[model samples]
Target: MSDFTQRFLFDDFDARGELVTLEGSYRHVLAKHPYPEPVAQLLGELLGAAALLIGTVKFDGLLVLQARSTGAVPLLMVECSSAGELRGIARYHAEQIGDAQSLGELMPNGDLAITIDPANGQRYQGIVALDGANLADCLSTYFATSEQLPTRFWLFADGQRACGLLLQQLPVDRQKDPEARAASWEHVVTLADTLTAEELLSLDSETLLYRLYHEEAVRLFEPRALQFRCSCSRERSARALVSLGREDADQLLAEQGGTVVIDCQFCNQRYPFDAADIAQLFAGGGVEPASDTRH
Candidate 1:
């Protein structure tokens, strides 16, 4: 099935949810990096989480989920645009990653940061300690602590595909009994917890929702397409070089035999700059003329 995210509301309860399954886009991300099995699985989970979280907010730029630690896996990050394009990368010490399965084992002393950057506005960020056994648990902790909302997440991934389900309780209406709203939230979350990883990866959204909430009044929205796309470009790379300043850029060119090479970690695309290119960039001439060769 095509990669997509489905949003659903519980008509009879004060809650909302999102389900995301990523196949083609997930595979495309894996194709760009040779991550170890454990690391690959973690990246997949983050990718799914990024998609679900991005769908829950309104922004025109990018949403980034990052985990940093001092354990075997030092850093794992995923970026998703408002347009549904996704990309991810993980950094780890291969020797230290042998067979580590849980979040604590893979990223001990870690912290998770979620950043929301709009195309035109101030960025917002929330940082939470990685205090749970898994990525899903850590994320749930984030919502509960930062947003003061009861939220839960089920995330699973193999090297091939990634899937996630997010459930959050909406604000209770003043006229409604608070006890009843709390009960409804607990009931639905209990049902969602019974979902197996196999079913999440294999079942479509409609069938999956029916299997979990067949008795409840649920409304499912149209699926939003998710794609694998990297925001990296020749122009962005040039700006990076320009940031290095004229002296540093010239020194790098001299050290690398008159051509500086920069490779994007997200896509492995190479951007090469010679003396002419560096001069043009430092001269304030935006990214080498269109005629400039790009690889």
Candidate 2:
């Protein structure tokens, strides 16, 4: 399968933007979970949003977008790193779902949360009450309230494809080209809003840009590929077992017949630890597991 793709740009004036569309990669992530239509769509949107944000930010860090509800869909978490790696998982109360058709109907009081884990700086978090009728509205509200920038976002996804657009207002020197900046931002967003879901899902970066901004003078950079990658492993699980204390680990191992197994909810990958694995993990004593070192 091809990697997920991200396209980025800055207006000749002061604003910046990104357009990201994912099909095969997004479908691969969603395939692990048998989510309802609304939940599945939400997961795809979150994945697109996370990829876009990761493309925009500068860090060897992780950007996570999460939506939680006490309603039918209990939890949805999407993680994207600076390198364009993506993974997501969703949990739901199947009994409560009861044939719900949309996010609003399924999660009456959902909340959206954004977390930025920078490699060097302190972790940051932003939370917003799910105000909009959909995930896009909720995230737009988040940007307006939390970032306080004149930002606009459009996100749409079906069970098969996910797409998103992000426009952010960059602070300009108040005296120079302010009019040009405002005009450019509005002009670009206007064109972007006219985009159809099919256009977003099917077109390549260059074609999509031309379709939207052919008349205008816009700079398009080389597109970066995004990928569906699960950051889970046996070593990480064993470390988690060590954190559970020897007695607790022993109890679980005893109940499970000398092995404790953890299934990654995101990728449906299993990490199992037998007795020797536990002994090795304990012998290492405080050595953290390598989450990035995948087998």
Top lDDT model: 1
Could you give candidate 2's per-residue lDDT for residues 18-116 as a string of tens digits?
878787778898778777787788788888888877875678889998888878887889999887889998888878888786778777788888999
Question: What stretches of model 2 exceed 4 Å from their correct place?
Answer: 8-12, 173-180, 285-295
Candidate-wise lDDT, in order:
0.90, 0.77
Q: Give me the runs in candidate 1 sitting further than 4 Å from their true place.
A: 289-294
Clash totals for all models, in order? Answer: 0, 1
* lDDT string, candidate 1, 1-295, tens digits: 4899999999988899999999998999899878888888999999999999998888799999999999999999999999999999999998998878888999999999999999999999999898797899999989888856788999999999899999988887531998888889889999999999999999999999999999998999999999999989889989999888889988899999977889989889888888888888877877755335664
Cα shift from native, residue 31, model 2 (Å): 2.3
Give me the overall lDDT of model 2.
0.77
Q: How high is each candidate's TM-score? A: 0.96, 0.87
In model 1, the Cα lDDT at residue 156 comes to 96
TM-score of 1: 0.96
lDDT of 2 at 187: 81
Candidate 1, poorest ten consecutive residues by summed lDDT: 286-295
